[model samples]
Structure formats: structure tokens, C-alpha cells
Target: MNQTYHVYILASARNGTLYTGVTGDLAQRMWQHRNGKGAKFASKYGVHRLVHAEAFTNVNDAIAREKAIKKWRRAWKLELIERGNPQWLDLYDRLNG
Candidate 1:
């Protein structure tokens, strides 16, 4: 069966510290981050807000995208997020709705 992967960026707040990651399940990953059970960096930096997410059918592509985003300049990352999420809203709720 085909699978979906996600490349996501989490932030502490608008323009705050950021965390980039790739996951097969966005909602579950975000839940872990929110509950301080995800990445150490994210929990330690309070970066649990899902600011941006991109879907991919291929896991390798998603991983590559995550790696690329992680190396992006802060301004570039913000621009990417703002293009899709102008207000930098937490997208976790949207996942359920």
C-alpha cells in the first residue's frame, strides 16, 4: 500500500525557535511533541506548535525535504511557513477537523 509522509516545522511561537522533522503520522508526532515525548530539542525549546507541514507520497522525498528545511536560513523558513500559514497558526486542530 502507498503511504503518506510529512515534513513539518514546529515553533515555540511566531518567529520563535523552530524544529523541522519528517514523520509518517503528523498528528501522532505533534501529540508527542505537545506532551514532551518527541524530540529532546523540541521539548527543551518549547517548540511544539505546528507552523508548517508538507505532504509527500515518498518517504525519501519527505526526509530530503526535512533535511533541506533544517538547513534553511531562518528568514527562508519563515517565508516558507508564511506562504501557507500567514498567521503561523498551530495546525494540529486542523488535522482532526
Candidate 2:
């Protein structure tokens, strides 16, 4: 199988809106969002800025993390992103094109 590691969150813009998800292909995922084809929630709400992500050894863990984040309060979710990425720069930039 293709290798991948992701539990991620995206915001519309600085604090505009938020989304939580899991995906193996971070770059492709972000590209889809950038093009407004990622998900209904992302396209409608404009949650396309990859503000946060976590790595896992496998999909199980990534899914668990995604579930955990889904249960978090919006403020807590914001805190998670603020802890590592105060500026919330598009993390996709860290990856090669």
C-alpha cells in the first residue's frame, strides 16, 4: 500500500472556519481543498488552509486522532493548532510539490 501519515485540521482563513479529517496523501488532500473539491464542508465553509496535522504509524491511529479531534470543543481545537502553529501557515508548504 502507499505510505501515508495524517490526522489533520484546516481552517478557512485565520479563524474563519475549521475542519478535521484524516488522509494518507496530505499534499493531494490540500490540493483538492485549494481547488474547492475536497469536501462539501470544506468547499462550502472554505476550510482549505492546512493549519494543523499529526503523524501516526498507521491509519488506525490516524483515525483515532481524527475522532478525538472531532469530539473536542472548538476552543480546544483552536488551542491544539495554536500550540504548534501559532501562525497557522499552510503546512502543505512544508512538503515538496
Candidate 3:
């Protein structure tokens, strides 16, 4: 079986703090973030709203994408999220629903 990995972006709100990460389980990771059990930066900044995500079959690819996004300018990152999620919705509920 092929395992899936995801590169995801979370935000405190529209035009608020942003976070990028890679995970094999997006839903579980989102759960962790929502509950304040994920990355220290996420918890510290209250960055728990899922704004964007991309899936990959390879973990390395996902990690690479995550790194690339992390290096992006804030405007670029916001554009990325706005392109797909203009409302900046919390996608975590969609993951499980």
C-alpha cells in the first residue's frame, strides 16, 4: 500500500499568523494542532485553522514542498492559500466529515 503524506498550511485567521508542516496523517495532525498538542510555534501563536494542503505519495516530496513553502515570502504564502481557499476556512472539519 502506498502511504500518503501532506504538506499543509494553518493560520490563526484570514491574514493572520501562518504555519507550514508535513504529515502522514493530516486529520490526526490537525487534531493535534486544534488541541494544542502540535508544534510549539502553532500552539504559541494559536495557528490552528487549516487553510491549505497538498498531498503526495512520497514523504520526501511532501517534506520538500513544506520546506519550499516555509521559505516563501508571507505574501506568496497568502496568495497560495487565497488561490485555493479565499475564505481561509478551517479545513480540518472537512477532513473528517
Candidate 4:
């Protein structure tokens, strides 16, 4: 089976605290974040809503994209999210559906 990699962004709310990360299993990672068992930054900042995500075939590319997004200005990050998720809705349920 081919492994899928993802570059994802989580937010506390619309235009709220944001966290960028990379993972092989997006559902599991989002579960951790929502349960406060994910990144310290995410838990501390209450950033659990899945606002943006991009799938990658390469883990290295996912990691690099995550790093780049993390380093981006807040405006750019928000723009990225808004491009796909205009309302900044939690995408967890959609992942399964």
C-alpha cells in the first residue's frame, strides 16, 4: 500500500491561533490535536479545528511544506486557508466522508 503524507493546518477559530504540521495519517493526527494530545503548541493555543490540508505523495515534501507554511506571515497563512476554506470550518468530519 502506498503511504500518503499530508500538510495540514489547524485553527482555534476563524482567524485565530493556527498550527501547521505534517503527518502520514491525517485523521489520527487531527484526533490527537482535538484531544490535546498533539503538538504542545497546538494544545496550548487551542488550535484544533482543521482549516486547511494538502495531500502529498512524498513525506519529505510534506515536511518541507509544513515548515514553509509555519514560517509564513500570518496573513499569508490565513490567505492559504481562506483559499480552500473560506469560513475556516473544521474539516475533520469531511475527512471520513
Indicate the worst ten consecutive residues by lDDT in candidate 4.
84-93
- When 2 and 4 are scored with TM-score, the better candidate is 4
**lDDT accuracy of residue 28 in candidate 3:** 92
Candidate 2 residue pairs in clash (backbone atoms < 3 Å): none
Residues 1-97, candidate 3, lDDT per residue (tens digit)?
8999999999998999999999999999999998989999999999999999999998989998999999999999999999999988888889978
lDDT of 2 by residue, 7-97 (tens): 9999988777999989888888889988978888999987888899897878888998899899999999998999999998988888784
- Candidate 2 residue 7 Cα shift, in angstroms, is 0.6
> Clashing pairs in model 1?
none
Error (Å) of candidate 1 at residue 29 is: 0.4
Sorting all predicted structures by TM-score, with the top scorer first, yields: 3, 1, 4, 2
Between prediction 3 and prediction 4, the one with superior lDDT is 3
Which runs in model 2 stand beyond 4 Å of their true positions? Answer: none
**Every model's TM-score:** 0.97, 0.91, 0.97, 0.96
Query: What's the number of clashes in each of the models?
Result: 0, 0, 0, 0
TM-score of 3: 0.97
Per-residue lDDT of 39 in model 3: 98
RMSD vs true structure, all candidates = 0.7, 1.6, 0.7, 0.8
